[model samples]
Target: MKEGIYYDCINDFLNKNRDIETKKLLLVAEYTNFELKKLESYSGEIIGAVVPFIVYNNEFFNKGIISCDLEEENNFLLIENLKEFSIEDSFFKKSKSLVVLVDGLSSYISDFLDNLFQNIPENTQVIGGGAGKMTFERDPVIFTKNQFCKDSAIIISLNKKLNLGIQNGWEYLEGPFLTTNSEKNILKTLNFKNAFEVYKQVVEKDSGKKFTDDNFFDIAKSYPLGIIKYDKEVIVRDPIFVDSDNNMVLVGDIPQNSTINILKGKEDNLIKSSGIATKKAMEQIDLNNENYCVVVFDCISRAIFLGDRFVEELEEMKKNINPSKNLFGALTLGEIANNGDEYITFYNKTCVTGILC
Candidate 1:
């Protein structure tokens, strides 16, 4: 496997690597600030998404494109409609890992992943992310070399299994609140009261910070909603903003009638959890085999919450891995990974890593 990061543009990178060896190329790049065009006479397939930032080695950046060449037998599928994606059973049978990238701004992902996880076998590991710009404006994020798309998802089936590490360090701040009136990703009413109003009452009292229109995301990142699932599991969901109806729009979906907790994070705990996640992945890696690739789907909200100390979170992950191996990933709008022997789902404000050997 080979990869490189370009700061200026992808056109120059495509021009430079026209003689690339593999047929599978992934272009994980920063949002639509760069110009793009199809390579004339190019025969290779390209798949990737636009993200807020790209993670490479020990550092992260906002203005760059990271292109990689896949080394295994892989199949790429583009789901223009997440609710109705189709594939034969042989597709998962032939794949050892599934890299799923979906539109971050869409509310259909939770249901989409639920159906997808049921179709795949236990031996198959899954990882990927929600693709969108930081500005939260609707635009094309997931794509092929020629197809710039929206309201879509791209599934890349790779023939290599993965060692996975997944963790989120958030403790309850309030809530045992009931999601009474919710639809898709919109939290309309919690416990039959206005969702945003209930959230504001708790968060303001806890942090002594008012939720202004401008600083909603900045404050909400530290205080997310946690939905309780079966087997003592809790999934985190980020409330990005409030809509005109005072509905809290979350990054991931929560069905109505679910129990939720308002979660809060400490800087130390969040950073340490990221390190623990990497350590778990490292533990699963074969010691004798020095060759492996690290791909992460970390939540973009974590970066905003950590602010200048976000480097500490990156350094924690870097500290556990072998310095010789490349640590590559994206600051996704949400994370995708399968839970231990349970099922796969979309997550918010968490870190999911895959060790491809």
Candidate 2:
């Protein structure tokens, strides 16, 4: 694998890695600095980039990068048409593989993965995040080597071994309310009551705090919804906004009839869980022989709730993983991972670590 890092914008990526011969490139950029619309008209072999809060060497920075492979170009496949991906495709036959995804639309990611996992081999490991800004604009830019796009996603297949671990420190606060009514990412009701009313009541009761329109986000940041999964795995769903009708809009989708619990967390627990997640991920792979990089897709909500203490979470990750190894990733709106047992899932307010070798 060949990698190049640049302090400049997306336009400078090719210049920095001119000598690297690669068929597919995985780009990670600072969300604030990247322009998504500029690459829409670009005409080149498919290459794509994601916008997230980037991490490197235990510090957060806004640097852009292009990671590519020269010799493994044949093993790499750039998938644009999610509907067209199939098991019979030569790309799925590889022995050990990793899929890096940069999705322009978070809503479509679940659907895309549903189709993707059905065709890919069981040994394949997937990692990536929803690429966009907090603005929640209609056109979030995902870029290619020479083009930018909206409402599209880039899927890169690489022949490599990856060990993944997922963890969320948020503790369950209330009942396993059945999702009585929901539409895509909007929660209309919980246990047949107005979603916001139930949420507000539960939070106020638990925290002894009042909820106002002005302070909703401040109060809601520490309290998110957890979707129960098999083997006691809970996928978190963050409530981003409350609609006029008091319906709660979430960062990711919550399926109807599914049981969910309200979750709450503290700074100490959140920070402590980061170390546990890192340690578990590192334990999955043999570090002595392989060249590995620890890639983390941590929820941005955690950082917001943690404030200055967020740095302590990063420090925990660094300490748990081999201190000499490279640690880098993005603070994402939503994180994606599949730990072999569960289906590949999209989660909010969670930490996902991938030890890629």
- Residue-level lDDT of model 1, residues 315-340, one tens digit each, is 88988988877778789999999854
* Cα lDDT computed for each candidate against the true fold: 0.82, 0.71
What CA RMSD would you report for each candidate? Answer: 1.8, 3.3
CA lDDT, candidate 1, residue 100: 88
Single out the weakest 10-residue window by summed lDDT for candidate 1.
1-10
lDDT score, residue 331, model 2?
Answer: 77
| Residue pairs in candidate 1 whose N, alpha carbon or C atoms collide under 3 angstroms | none
Query: Please, what are the lDDT tens digits per residue for candidate 2 over residues 1-357?
Result: 333233445566545545544454555655435555544433334365565566664666546654544344435444454444443456667635554554534555667767767777776777777666656564545665456555556556656677887788899899889999998788999889998999999999888999887778788998999999767788899888787888998877789999999999988999988888888888978756557767888887898899888889999998877766767767777888885534778888888887777
Q: Which portions of model 2 miss their true places by more than 4 Å? A: 1-15, 23-32, 35-46, 62-71, 74-88, 102-105
